[model samples]
Target: MTKSKTFWAASALISLALMVFAGYSIYGRVALHFSGDTIEVKPVPLPAAEEQEEEKVDTKSALEKIKAAEKEDKEEEAKAGRGTPAKTEVPRMRAVKTAFEYKDSAAKSVLISGSFTSWKDKKMTKKDGVWKTDIYILPGTYPYHYTVDGKKKLAPGKPKAPTGDSLVTVN
Candidate 1:
């Protein structure tokens, strides 16, 4: 009878120990999951109005200095030129009527792009299955191509340069 009582008591104590260990593990896991076991707080300072004003003053002074330096450089250039207008005159640009034609009847849209147009999409109009557009090009060599339905096509009878674009000379 004594041996049986001791065995029952030992089993109850072991079971209680395992239950306590499992409860502690669950509590630790939940605490770490919710708040990561620590709280971090930081304080941020607000900017002062006087500090901002000082920064503005510094910026203004720097701009004034730059303006003064530019004025001095212009005066020096004027003195070197001996009281005459700056050399070299800008060439007068003229509007030249240019035309392009795409003979493909299957094309849905056509565009003319060149250096004057900044290589942007300039949509052309279709007339009797021919795509045409008039561009006012300056007197220079421009590399251009045609975009027919989102496909790049070089101008007909114009060979592509090493830069992979057909050249056009406006005089």
Candidate 2:
């Protein structure tokens, strides 16, 4: 090949390779950001059986204290001739079927947790490179996130929560 043609071809190849490398780098960064690599997960140990029993006893005592206080309030109201307070009906909130999804083809397990689940991890089913779960939730906003392979990850494109987690709203 002519020196000029050979030089031109080499330059073109180099340019193409540079472009490919830049494109791959950008893709990797975007993927890592959306995949929740920035979020950290810390495992909390469960309470022991003895501690659970103690908590039950404490709950019983707390309930008894509340009942006693209510009785005292009623007695005082009776003495003041206020009679019994009329019961007001509180409207019940209907639960909406909400779907949560996380995409991670490499993940072996995915779980979702939030105020709705009492912060307990709920397992998600995987299908076609997506992990998903449906939960019946009352109409409200709740902070939540996904646990992919035991690491906390927020759902991509979702709003951020005050606690630095992802937010989900059910209506």
Candidate 3:
């Protein structure tokens, strides 16, 4: 074969090998991601017939007590010269402590961004091969994702948001 032809063939083979290596690397990372996680299921016991009947009775009594309490409140308001209580402002929701975690041993840096953070990246701390961050958030549903080494990745096993991010409900 001509030297030029040999050089071209060698280049093509090298390119093919590089592509395969890249593909395998990606596959291994993905496999590690899925395989390292675990899920636990605990069986729940059904209530006894007597317990179910008692629960129904208790629920009815509780509802009746609530109605009586509301009636007393309205009567007190009327006596206080407020015929109907003025519309009270809704109480602000308290922020709840929420934890976010991700596992990626190869990542140099991990960050989290979401509606809670106004889409700003928040750096996560790494410990024992896991990345973790705790943020206080108001009770509601929010969409979020991780940025590992500057690349976006969804939370594993989480429901996808409309914008293709992971969904987290804080309460």
Candidate 4:
């Protein structure tokens, strides 16, 4: 009979393992007649009908609770507003990024990694020193840096981040 190589190999392996285990167990029993082993087994009783009835009855209430939770989340977000965010929250942004093209690779492409911006490579490199990249950013002040490869490099002292990797705050 013809069998696929993979199928035969898998079947043979499983049969071999079973046979070996069976042989080992038999050998252990025959050679070392006495055997003693213990395993703990416990049965946990499920909650009875009254509790189950109450639990099932509460599903609607649970759904209401979930709705209430979602409503609370929305309220909290609105109250927090775009500008007023937790120290950890970098609010979602639309503008996202700003790119520059320098003269050459004298500068490096840096990822604006921080709570304020979300993009990895926030800046771009110029063919020679030109940069062309946009920074997705929230509408607020953000502390960021110009990363050359992986290290931080101070942007030239210019008002705009694209011009001189100066620390910029988006509004």
Candidate number with greatest TM-score: 3
Error of 2 at 119 (Å): 0.4
- How much lDDT does each candidate structure score? 0.75, 0.82, 0.83, 0.55
Clashes of 3: 0
Looking at model 3, report the run of 10 residues with the lowest lDDT sum: 35-44
Q: Which residue pairs come into collision in candidate 1?
A: none
| Model 4 lDDT tens row, 1-171 | 356888899999999999999999788654432232211122345767997889878997998998798778778888878554344355554774645333335544544443344323455636545655665554554334556777765546534342233455554
Clashes of 2: 0
lDDT per residue as tens, model 3, 1-171: 699999999999999999999999888755643553321222345767998899999999998998798788888989988866656476888999999999998899999988778778999999999999999987777778999999999999987765568888875
**Among all windows of ten consecutive residues in candidate 4, which has the lowest summed lDDT?**
33-42
Question: Which candidate number maximizes lDDT?
Answer: 3
lDDT of 1 by residue, 7-76 (tens): 9999999999999999998887556435422221222357769989899999999989987987787788
In order of appearance, the predictions have TM-scores of 0.46, 0.48, 0.54, 0.32
What candidate 1 gets wrong by more than 4 Å, as runs, is 1-91
